[model samples]
Target: MQFTAKFNALAVAVVAAMVSQVAASPAPVASVVSTDEFLKWLDTTDADITYIGKPINGSVPRAAQDVMVTYCNKRTQNVCGGTCTVYNGPAACLAAGGTACLSATANVGFCDRGGCGGSCNQLSTCGTHLDNGFCFTPGTASIIVPPS
Candidate 1:
């Protein structure tokens, strides 16, 4: 009985130590920003933005209708710059040609092939995170849009 009690006390202490360690750890940062926030950043950035599929006119609110994804060919000081294409729709496979950086309002998958057939990685697991929630996705051939 004494041995069992001692083992139980040790186990409780171990569990308490683990819980304390977890509580002391910092919370993970969210890789994807909100649609409104991403659009606001796009407005302020100097990167030339082009719309793919249907153009976002003043008649429609972009966030309500479409998932916006922006891909660029340059990365300067953690910023996605150069000529950037903003794909504004729920496309199964977005051909991100020669993309060096990417950002999206929603979490998507970046693939190595044009048709999203090759090895893919989630935007949330971005190896190199850039400024304004962009990911340094060099050689990204396509982006797989998640269904709404």
Candidate 2:
């Protein structure tokens, strides 16, 4: 009987210790930003991508751009005479419709053909480049809401 009583007391103590330890543990912190907030900040839906080429200011969201250039190490290559800001990582990349460490981004430029004046293009491709005497200009970044 004494042994049973001690065993029961020991069991209770163990349970109590576990409960106390759990209670003392820190609350779980959010490791990643919320999806809704991320989308909002990204200013685009999963369907479409924001192409922020360089004008030193362009289509990418201010916050997302900051994160990309700062946290994601986006760089300029003059991929189109206009600077193409490429970033890979985190929610921003996914939000930008890019995958595998790259966001969906394209180059920015205009057709420099004597007859194609003002014929603009904003993709990774252009028949004209800086060497072709065509200048680059980034397009506006737009915000989008996903369909229900």
Candidate 3:
């Protein structure tokens, strides 16, 4: 009976170790930002945009009915190249006139270490990173609107 108990404990320990390793692994970097993250980014200033983790390439915007953003992609490999805005989705950002915000280009990727395209030399701010996108700031007010 004692041997059986010991075996059970050992098995549990092994399982626990395996679980911890899986949890620690990085999440598959998103292809796009979630709706909630996009909305939050709108209200955030340039200094804090990285808080929700960078948006991965090919992410779809979740702007609301009146939100807008300016996206730029120097690489030109994706449609989100240059400035754009969110249109409709989980967090669609609409304009004050009730027009939809511009959707980010379909091909843009989040600016990460690898995606910077080796042009880090000229960057004083994030502009050196060609893939970076910015939500137009003094962003839309922080009004609590229901999700679409």
Candidate 4:
């Protein structure tokens, strides 16, 4: 009887701790980044990336509808000066192939990194770089409406 009572008390304490943890967790944030800001931010991050393709019409968040990001997924092979290199992903592939890849392509879709999450890289403040945080999708991201 005493053991049962202690077990129940421990369970209650565990449940209370879980509830408090959930309540203390922070919420997700979203935004729409601008072009000029992106360009400047690009210089800051100095990421090795290039335009791969466009985003497919998947369901976009209402707040994010005005702007959407379509990351590319191009994996192919390239012969750089007789040295063949298997390219994996459009951005990296393009950067490797350089001008030679501008006219070529492979395949693309929404870039899902199994990451924690994603959000918009608003102007004035640049978000994370491609692959690391913000730029999860690798394709081209255009603003449906100018940054507000």
Most TM-score-accurate candidate = 1
Per-residue lDDT of 123 in model 2: 25
Q: In candidate 1, list every pair of residues with a backbone clash.
A: none
CA lDDT, candidate 3, residue 63 = 33
Task: Give the winner by lDDT.
Answer: 1
Sort all candidates by TM-score, best to worst.
1, 4, 3, 2
Tens digit per residue, CA lDDT, model 2, 1-148: 9999999999999999999998896742222223233334344322233344232234344543232311111213522212233332233221221111122221222232222233433323422232112222232222111111
lDDT of 2 at 93: 21
For residues 34-57, could you state the per-residue lDDT of candidate 3 as single tens digits?
444555545552321211113333
The per-model lDDT (C-alpha) reads: 0.83, 0.31, 0.33, 0.30
Better of 1 and 2 by TM-score: 1
Report RMSD (Å) for each prediction in the order shown: 4.9, 16.8, 14.4, 14.1
| TM-scores of the candidates in the order shown | 0.74, 0.24, 0.26, 0.29
Query: For residue 81, what is the lDDT in candidate 4?
Result: 18
